[model samples]
Each structure stands twice: as structure tokens, then as C-alpha cells.
Target: MEEVDVVIVGAGIVGLSVAEKLSHSFDNILLVEKEDSFGRHISSRNSEVIHSGIYYPKNTLKAKLCVKGNELLYNFLEKNNLPYKKCGKLIIAIQKNELPILDELYQNGISNGVKNLEIISSKKAKEIEPLFKSCGALFVPSTGIMDTHKVMKKLEFLSEQNGVLISYNTEISAIQKQDDEYILSFKSDDFQVKTKILINCAGLWSDKISEMVGINSEKNDYKLLFCKGEYYKTTKYKDIKHLVYPVPDPKGIFLGIHTRINLNGELSFGPNAYYVDKIDYQMDDSYHQEFYESVKNFLEIDFDDISQDDCGIRAKLQKEGEKFRDFVISNEKNKGFPNFINLIGIESPGLTCCLSIAEYVEKIIE
Candidate 1:
């Protein structure tokens, strides 16, 4: 048995961020990952957008943490010499009727303390983005893109520098709460170990992990709906300057198809949300036609050059037709394990809000 003060499962951004903060306060911290490399899951597969905290409801954890994390992330990137760009974003209203919704989003953003969100006229929008055609748009200057893998590496490095032990290829088998601490069982290629305090940041398998610890009562009320979003790269427009997004559905389960330019200056649009049974990354070429039709209303580009790139799954906590749900951070209250914490359905803005989630989890442990 290799006892530790804290054991963090999953080496995704959130887990690594939590380890980074806790490493400074506690020694004997262990970070376990099932993958051969860190961030093989949601952390690496996202659109890499540093969100501006515009959509979430006011004062909720998502809104507050996203706003705060936006500031913290940019500062951290600058301090660490990471590759990132504040390319900005535009939420366009293609239909005249959708303009009201766009306006409401702008007001909501203002109320949420999202700085520099402006509602620009269609002419102004076209002036800003010559290829964009819309009735109206909301400009969010804080939205941007970054090398998420690099960010994760930096986080892991910092945590390791502070004495947090990272063990890749290690999978947690079970967790049990003892008198004063958690007893966690983990198996790796070579060995097995047990630890004390358990931090369940196991992205997709979070509910299963909680159940393993006999915390079924605290398991998410809504089943994890695996919504896989597929992206397509545009060979025609390779150097787009801004992220172009459509007015999100009022329900807000999925942000409409949008374009994001990566750190390499390659433009890609996608993630048309589709519910799936398994975590599959297979891109269906048939959807490419649908992508062309869906995005043509807002963007003026040659769809002939569009091709499948990659796909990422969102651990959506919301049921079908329901609005987007907030991140679930469960501690002793629901689970009965004093030191055990589980983070479930941490999807979009999750990459942006990773550090803030870490700080929140730290407060819970303390």
C-alpha cells in the first residue's frame, strides 16, 4: 500500500490543475492516468477556445469560474510562454428574427460581467469579417484559442515540480472511504497501489467511479449523454482571423456550428452536436454535406474544400431538449466520503475554467 495525502485520478486539465494547486499545500500527492499520455480525452479533443464567459447564467459556478479562469489562464499563458492567441469571436444572427436573441445574449453577457462584449450591426460585422454575412452579431474580444496540449503539459510540469507524482498508464479500480481517509485501489502495467484521499476527476467515467465507492445515491441524476461533435477543416480559408459562431439555440445544449482558427493558423468549423451511444471518434463523411448546409447561412466559403478533421465527445449532463447544465462538483455532502470529491459533466468552458475548478476543489478539501 502506497498511502498518500491526496490521490487525483485522471490527468486531464482539471485533474492536473487540481494537482498543481494541491502540490503547493500537500506533499505525497499522486496523480494517476489511464492513458499512455496525459490529456488523451476531452482536454486534447476540444475546440481549444478560451471562452469569454458569455453564455452561462449569472453567479453560477460556470459563469463565475469561466470569467475568473479566463483572466487566470491568459495570465498563466503569458507567464509561462505558452502558445495562445486572443483571436476574438463573433456570434452572428443569420435570420432577422434571431437578432433579438443575440441582443439578449449581449445583455446577459454584460450582466455576467463579461467585459468588451458589443452588439455590432451587420455592416460593422461585415467590415470586421469580410466573409461573414449576418443580420447582426455580438463581438466577444476575450474568446481565443490555444494549444491545449501544451497547457496541459505545462500544468503537469508545474505540478511535478512541486512534488506531485504523476503515474501514467495507471487506472483506478475502486475507492473506499475509511475512518479518516479514502482507500483507493489502482492498477498499472507493473504494479498496484492504494492511497488515501481520492479526487475523482475521471472525465467520462466519473459516475462509474462514484458508484465504485458505493456513492450511487450521489450519482448524477441525469445520465451522461455522450454528444460527439465533429470538426471539418477548410482548405479554402486557412487564415481566418476570428472565431465565427452562430446564435446559440435558446435552449443552449449545443453552441451552433462555429469556426475556430488553431494555433497553426488553420481554420476549422464544426462540432455539430450529435448524440451517440459510445465514445466514438469516427467522422462520418455524410455529415460533411450537412455541415456545408448548416454553416453556409453564416459563412461565405467554398465547401468543396471542407474535409473531416477530428471529433470530440462532450459529457453533457443535460437530457435531450434541455438546456446546458453547470459543472457538478460533489464532495462529502452527497457522497458521504469526507475527503472524496467527484467532478462530473465538466464539458465546454471546462478547459477555460480548469484552474478555477481546481481552486474550488481545493477549498472543498481544506
Candidate 2:
């Protein structure tokens, strides 16, 4: 029966970013998380790569927000003393036939205002990463990686300092709209609290959360398809300085098996896309054969000791055989509920775009 100004569900990066921004303006804010800690879902499971916003179509939310967010994130990390690296990335064209596609990608990056993107010859590409063998490549100097968990922790701390209450292990059951306010029912520990504005930032379960609010169900137009991607870690540390990528599939849904190094300088690969029926993270060893075949085309590696590390699911708005969908941040109109916002299908570059998404959401509510 407590009345609060805002109730944000899901403690992932997006929700936490929004909460951090909202707390600066609103005093009575509650951040609820079904899990015991933040970033346990999609936020923590990703490749932790800070995207350069080169792949998305121009003028779309993904393109604009990701480009904007990339700058903001770099600045934030530097200012806050967080761990990060602007290690750059290389989009490699392994075969002769893929050269044209590589050119198209370089032009797309330039058109999208991606700074310092250069088309390097195969010889120059080898200078950057000696082990990589490619016909041609595009070097994205702005692409980087970071510790996603550390960033989330900083956001959480900042929000708490600004008077935002973070309630963990809290699950929202139902939501209803009454006049200008939204009533949210959630259980925390042994108690429950109902509040006015409810922001659903549930990454994977966002669709189910929308249905709970009487929106985007079988009767509605919006739907979410869960896509699972798995990652594998290489045992031997190869000296690949930059993040190496193969020419993206024309469909643009999957970014072929690539190489990424973490903050500790450990190399990891994979995240091949596969559509799934349910949300699960169980690693299947049988997929190793498929992974080896997929990655062997671009880089040579000893897969002898390679093992499954982790997996992440992307909540996509598109169905099977569909191109990548843009981020959907809606409030009220789509579901007829004022002060209730639903963010569905926030996948790749999501971590990079977290700050920009938060700033946009704050403007919407303001």
C-alpha cells in the first residue's frame, strides 16, 4: 500500500542505468530485482564488448543510441576509474569473394559517423594481428571491451547514493493501471509492495512481464523471440591484440565467430546464434564440433582444450528468419498504461547503449 514515485523491475544494466538517472531527479525510487544480485542475466552473460555502432542501419535507435552511448561509456569509465580498453577491432574478410561485403561495411560505418574507421589491406591487417589471415579488413579503432559487472556495480552505487532503494530477490507478479498511476504487485522476501510508475527492464523475461501488464500477449501485436548464443574459451593465450571478426552474414543477425579478450587478457570466442524455445544456460558439449567448424574458416586455433565458458540469450522482437530488430522502448500508448514503460528486445550493443537508453527514458518521463 506504499506509494512511490517509480518502480523499476530488473536490475540489469538497462534498468540500473535508468534507475541511476531517475534517482538524480526523483527521491522516492525503488529498483526491484528478481535475482539476488544485479547483472545476473543478459547483462553479465554477454561478450562485454563495447560496440562501435557500425552494423546498425543509420537513423535507427540502435545506431544513434549505440554511437552516442559508446562515447558516454568511454568517458564514464575513464572518469570513474573503471577497467576498460579501447583495443580496437578488425572485421576480416577471409576469402576473396567477401571483399565487396567488407567495402560495404566500411562505407556503412563512415555513413553512420563512426570515427577513425579505416579499410586496411591484408598486409596491414597482418601487421596489427600477425596470426590473422584475411583478404581485407576494416579496422574500427573505437571498438573496445570492459568489465560489465563492474560498470553495473558503479551504476548501482551511484543510484543508491542518490536515494534509490535497490530491492533484490523481488519478483513482480502483476501490474494494473488506475487513472494516472500504475499499481505494481511484487513479492520481496516475506513482504510485498505496490507502487505507482513501473518500468519493466526485464531483459529475457520482458515479454512475460509485458503480458502480466495486459500487453504484448497472444492478443497483442508485440512478440519476443529468445535467441541463445554460446561462447567458448581457448586454453592457450594467443597474441591477438585486436578483436578479430569474420565478415558478417548478409542477413546481419549473426556476426560470425570472433575473438575477444577480457580485462585480464584472457581470450574467448564464439556466441554463435541459435533460436531456442526456452531460456536456459546449460552448455552442450556437442556444439563444440559445430563451433570448431564455424571458427576454423577465419582463425587457426588449437581447439584441443577449448571448453564452453558461458552463454547469453538475446530477447529479439523478430520471429525466425527475420532480420535484426531495433530496440523497443514504449510507455503507456502501446499498452494503455500511463507511467508504465516496457523495454523489450534490447540485445547487442545494449551494454554499450545503456547510458543513452537511460538518458532517453529520463527525457520521456520528464
Model 2, 80-174: lDDT tens digits are: 99999899999998998998888888887877889999899999999998887899899999999999999999999999999999989889877
lDDT of 1 by residue, 247-267 (tens): 885667778888968988898
lDDT of each: 0.85, 0.85
Off by over 4 Å in 2: 188-194
State the local distance difference test value for candidate 2.
0.85
State every prediction's TM-score relative to the real structure: 0.96, 0.96
